[model samples]
Target: MDDTPREEAGDEGAPPGGILDGTQEKSAQGGPPPPARSAPRRKPGKSRDHSAKRLANAGLAITAPTSRALGSTTIGGQLSAQLGTVAVSDTRGSVTQISYTATVSATNFTTTVGGNTSTISKPNISYWSGPATAVSGVGVFTPGQLAAANAIALTGSHTAFAVTSAVGNTSVSWNPTIIVRVPSSAAAGSYSGTITHSVA
Candidate 1:
């Protein structure tokens, strides 16, 4: 018997005679194997819906001095008698002139007057004075009618009088008064006039 063993042939279910094929097959012969299949892609989830809403809220609330009268309540009276007064004097027996101060006070008054009611919710009072005049030696001094230098200065010390009530309750009151002085040159005479007061 020969000593050499039989060589394996290709396709005989046996090893090839050479060690192994070194060159790679070209795609033209059988083409590279199909590329690996990838898993199906998933779609992105929908974004969260964002919508604005309008809201509203509502709430509601409801909210709301001094001169003397010359006559009686039924009529009127000198409102400043007790609160104010005037005085005069002569020095050397020479003719002198003097002027009296006029003052008005309101007791129960309001910012707005509707018939008998006032719009003022609280009580308030004010006072005012007129300008002063000088007396000359042996000369006459007559106090001019108390005129409001301006609308604001008319009331003298107390310009506006406000109160919650009139006489009984005593909610509020203003007592405005004035005093007069006579110089050696002042004249004597009775001075009178109407002091106007408006509720409104």
Candidate 2:
């Protein structure tokens, strides 16, 4: 039972120049060559601001005015400031503990020149966590003293400050010592007072 009337072959088992040949046919111009399109997919990249930065480096020099020393208790003439913090943490895979804090500003010590007036009790600080060398006393505000304001934590608790490594912008230095005290009834013409130092 086999009818001999068959002549239909447009795309099936018919190869000779493409038409559904064996390997997906390929001859008469692009057909099965456009199904391998895998070059149109890209959407991954968005992040900026490495983060973290704190710098305070300004003129600091207080040790004049007749060498400060009226009488009795005297320790005037002390100024230092070199705290830095520029970090990116690079990538932060682990180990991270960086801290910083110190404050001061008119906690005491004022002078209204003339009219009889004097001050000498709001200047005493000391800190040296890195790079130190400034004559008299040697930083640490006389043992890290701030007297008031409350905000001195250069490396206390909080993992004692740290900077293991992350990637870029890595800096860590501290040195703040400004202790000035004048007793003996501090009172004399030409007496100025103004203290302010902060970092966090």
Measured against the true structure, the TM-scores of the candidates, in listed sequence, are 0.20, 0.20
- Which candidate achieves the best TM-score against the true structure? 2
What overall lDDT goes with each candidate model? 0.24, 0.28
Candidate that would win on lDDT: 2
Off by more than 4 A, model 1:
1-158, 163-171, 182-185
Range of the 10 consecutive residues with the lowest summed lDDT in candidate 2: 18-27
Per-residue lDDT tens digits for candidate 2, residues 1-200, read: 11222222223443222111000101111113355655655567644333333112111111111112211122233333332221111122224433233333333444454465555454332233333122221122221332323334322222112333222223323333333434446543223333333333
lDDT of 1 by residue, 1-200 (tens): 11223222233543322111011101111123577998566667844433321111011100001122221110111122223222122222212322222223322222111333322111212223332222223332333323433223222333333221111111112222322221222121112222333221
lDDT value for model 1: 0.24
Superposition TM-score, candidate 2 onto the true structure: 0.20
Q: How far is candidate 1 from the true structure (C-alpha RMSD, Å)?
A: 54.2
